[model samples]
Target chain A: MTIPIDVETKHRIVVVLLWLAALVALAVLAFIIAVVLWNGLPAVTLSFLLESPRDMGRAGGIFPMVVSTVAVTLLAVIVAAPLGVGTAIYLTEYTSETALTRVIRFGAECLAGVPSIIFGLFGFIFFVIQLGMGWSVLSGGLTLAVMILPTVMRTAEEAIRAVPESFREASFSTGASRWQTVTQVVLPSALPGIVTGVILGVGRGVGETAAVIFTAGSSLHIPTSIFSPARTMAVHFYILAREGISMRHAYGTAAVLVILILAINTAANWLMLRFQAKQG
Target chain B: MTVARREKAIERALLVSALSAVSMLALIAAFILIEGAPVMLRHGISSFLAGTRWAPTKGSFGILPMIVASVVVTLGAMVIAVPLGLSCAVFLAEIAPRRAANFLRPAIQLLAGIPSVVYGFVGILFLVPLIRENLGGPGLSVLAAVVILGVMVLPTLIGIAEDAIEAVPRTYKEGALALGCTHAQAIRRVILPAARGGIIAAVILAMGRAVGETMAVIMVIGNAAIIPCSVLDPARTLTSNIALEMGYAAGDHQKALFATGVVLFAFIMVLNSIATMRIVRGRR
Candidate 1:
């Protein structure tokens, strides 16, 4: 028989391997953030943040793209938040497990799985062509609204379900209607979680490219209205890098995007932690 | 009576809002099929599905090469990602101290929050050049896409897989330890087997992410339409084909691009079905 390693030694070796794996996973994140910031941070400046692009994005700042990003993301959240919360309310408060609920859940799950590019295609045909919205902020925002809907719904559902059942019962014994109980008690307790979900949806909308590029129409011009075709920061970065327009500009844009996303994610995580602490 | 009437109206409104997801799904499928299906029918399904040539201007539209490239790059990514993700997940669930796991969990979700465009930019700056200098192929190849995607899918894989592993009852581990098993051996024999269904589900879900990935894959994959003979060779994927060509395409070319989207949607639906089924089975 082959010489066998002692159990304690073997266990130590495995633990070391697992530690290395976790370290490697974390390292990848650290390295990507470090590399992007290292190269891009110097390029970010006051003018770079405030001025519009010039020379087909070879020079000047990303002010227009910034505005477009905010406009589109805000519109998406405005459209999606109520619908998502309403869906969550319906699922958790108004119904129990049934065929209808199952169908709704299945539809939401399938929607979640559909890829962004397909959403692009659907938006292109339905909103851009059939509905005659064209490639504009309106179409792009609507498309992203649909894209982030499942995420919003799922998060809201979890938050609502986490509210104690006894709270609902107390409202009922006080002769509150189901709708009154949900609106007054359930939603208030779930507000932090719902806001977290909305923030997450905003984060996804901010960074989306493929779907936005098709529906939003990547114009360098600042959007004056929802009908205006304007580029977002993500789409602008994609075009610059892919077309090899200007590496410096691309890096600066990337830095901004990375920092913005990091902030949103941190905010969401903090809110979630606070919510959990309160629940406990 | 008035309160009851008001309550019923509110319930109806909420129910209508709840139907939005289902309606959106139906509309997306119907619209994509309406735009894409005709082109597929015109080309004959087999030619589009199995044809090798894909010159839109020349009236040739075959997507076999892109299909093959998507499958190969996705599978290659899974190969690189699965072991790394599983070990990290295991570390989080079992080996890591509570303080460390708490800090690290959010850190990984941050990884997912990084935009795909940024991932592509990073790949272009570092990974592509690295591959070119060392690996001998054009830096933008299937290999580059695989490496980038492997890292991209890690968050999804680790998050779900860790949940699955942690869901196994503590008694299973205690039983193994009581029977004179080492910690590593007990994990290998009992904990892992108990978590098998969830682990498999995690893999399938990650596979879906890898396949649906667009911006990063487009940047690094060189986007050549031909099938690659090796991972080092350049290739285009189904999503990229749509993204790259949809801008200037007209008429049938546009429809062909939509047809590509149809194919991608179908592939993802299949993956989603399998993952959901696995999750359901695991729960049972």
Candidate 2:
């Protein structure tokens, strides 16, 4: 097809427009991070990190929220990683292109597209009300695990598939069983990629607000057990901002959350790049 | 156990684990439907969907306004995000130097990782006041939601669209170039057409994400439960409707929220199917 504009001029204009688009995306990221950090970094003193909130989060620190964030994130990764990695192993190592694999893949793809709010609803009904787990870390963690399961499975599948068939063959050439070959050879080669997936899941679980809020129950107090309702930093930030309670505290919480997410994302990207480099 | 028996057991265990995604999807669908479907059945799907008022306290749960809000906001966001996201994807995949692409890729990933709540917080502080003063009406209108959600969906759109663009066969570009086409002409005519399926799939997936977002929408949507006459008018989404009320809602109110979830889930499933079809067709 021919264009009204000259090709060279159109190419130049389009390239400039594309560059501007990328700049806008970058500016958005920078603006969010800079604004949050500028408003929030002052609130992140040692006392702020160590002390519990007082006066409904208008005063004091986010000690309880920190503990809750760590506990919930850990629990989610613990539950999701094995199941996700195992699913990857099954799909890549034990199976070929088949109806069963396609069904499983479809299920995963659909799950990935399901919104966090739906996951929250499911967890609220199933784990919280039906199972009597209530709004607690357990409910939140389990819900998050389900939400991030697809990420883990997809990453692990990619990693496992990248492993050379010759490695498995070499292991099988020994007296090793199929299971042994997979466990020793394939999994070892895929470890970095699997770790990247787990880290990505961790970042997602940590940054989650909607699913965590309903299932975890945004309590300000430090959680005593898995069953104890607790507030994540993201939920805390949402509550503070929404209620117009404490803009300062909200910024502080947001800053901390942003910092954590940035660190986690950077780590995951680094690991993925390193893995890709190794594979290449 | 014999070695073969052990291997079989291990394979069985892995297979069971592999079934986790399917079972989880099944359980989620069943639970949401079980809790939400009764309300839809009781009220009749037509009245439930077509009704405008959402006074849960008074037992009226028409969600037409919220549905309209969701669709309008999603469409608005998509209008803003798709062109910019597609342009960025094309630039990165076809135009950018290798080092620049490598650096920007992670930055985009990090952008995606920024929690929705943070975006909402920023929106409340910045977009709300800016719109309130300049655009008139409530600052937390569908416009605010459109801007935030448009930004939120960018990473997903760009990432997938970039992959799609990159996946186009090199021979197609070469063939176009050999026809005395300029670099831009080769891409616009040959590469982009070949990448149409993936780009469409990406857009649909991003649309799903925008539709499902909650905390961010709630924070800035003004939550009036009214049909927006204009982009500047305050509106509520199905997601914000559920999230706002689920905390204090009980009895029928609670079920109504679940029913809202059912609607959202059904909408998302439709989007997912369309995107999946596009992806599958692209593969062929």
Candidate 3:
């Protein structure tokens, strides 16, 4: 099939060029990851992480940040999980694909697409101002809960949809009600996917800065309660960068943030894989 | 006294409340408007949209450069992201061997999980300096914003495009190859055309991500209100503008920040409508 200077070869060349371009982009991404890790890894020690920022500003440990991220993210998932999973149950089990379902679907899309800053703005006016939550962990968690609802809803919906029709038919043959089947059989089957959604939602909450900044009111100390003001690691990084804390805790904070992201992302991947394997 | 009765009540509740998702959405819109309307009303729409200077301290809360910066950053991100992301899609779907793809797929997606603020850090350390030295700038400009956004968006584009390409029928490739076309040629002509809708969806989704991205864009954008005549010039985007100013803002100034959010909200809602429309229409 060899031909002299074939057009097919020329086209293949272009495609290969595209492939190379993509590979190069990946390489660049890898380089960025490598450099950041290189700079960050060397600086992070156990003491760097164990000590709080208040040790005459010498201790670089992110105790407050780590605690705030965990606490706020916990509250966010607890809020979002029930609502999102409930909505998914409603859409998948109870409702028809009627105009209303269509409208809600559209609403979910809109809510998801709404920018973080807009979420922040709304949170500031409603939660921080009108309700006078006063830059507390509660406001940030609620705002992030709203922000992550669509993600959980969509995934949970998909999870429900992917459950086999035969399972329903099988249950019906045994005189089992639709509600019984959904709650007992379907929910269990879709639990992994639901968990995946919750984890990803929590991950987003942990890494979020912009939305929290407006609602949470940027406090540094560990909060005594949900209403207490606080700051997460991401916000701390923002402050460090904005306040010109250059070449100091900034790099370490950045590293901590990256590691947190990577941890969450890894968990998400593992869950997704588990979900697929379960389906298979 | 039956399961059906219980189901009926539950279903009714679900139906009524689900419809309220609309009002909830409208509530978000309403709140943004209600809270932000005072600023636009006070300053008039022209001054809010068209005013050049953004001295919130002096009651000059113009956001024209911020708007310009948002557009410039988004467009620049698209320039770098679209080609690379599409190619990556093409590679995974059309070029790479299946085993290799299976191994690498999750890793590729893992990039998406990297938090925006972390990406901001990477941009500040790596991209800001790179642009400063090579492009000849101080640091933290529209260029840095573009590079960060582009990198951040790559996973989205590739994921969407890969799914689209995978959905292309084997017959399309077979038909092209049957007519003396190579694998690449078949992909070029037939697979790509068939997957255009999905590719377009990917781009739109990426656009949505770009427009909404706040922490990362803010971290690297230098937060300058001046219109960027060059990529090297510092700029401020809509998201960054709000994030930067939402603190310590009160009165009309606070309302204007909310107004900025309303504008961003409107844009994102349009994008959301498109995504939903495509989904519903495509289903039929």
DockQ of each: 0.82, 0.87, 0.57
- Expressed as tens digits, the lDDT of each residue in A188-238 for candidate 1 is 999899999999999899989988999999999999999999899999999
- Tens-digit lDDT track for model 3 on A107-183? 88788777778778777778887888988889988888888888888888898888888888888889987788888
User: Which candidate should be chosen as best, given DockQ against the real structure?
Assistant: 2
Q: Model 1 off-target regions past 4 Å?
A: A1-3
lDDT tens per residue, model 2, B2-55: 999999999999999999999999999999999999998998899889999889
Name the TM-score of chain A in model 2: 0.97
The window of 10 residues in a row where model 2 chain B has the poorest summed lDDT is B275-284
How many angstroms is the interface RMSD of candidate 2? 0.7
CAPRI rating of model 3: medium
After best superposition, candidate 3 residue A234: deviation in angstroms?
A: 1.0
| Native contact fraction per model | 0.79, 0.85, 0.61
- After superposition, the stretches of candidate 2 with alpha carbons farther than 4 Å from their true spots are A1-5
Query: Candidate 1, A24: how far from true, in Å?
Result: 0.8
Docking class of 1: high
lDDT of 2 by residue, A20-75 (tens): 99889899999999999999999888898999999999999999999999999999
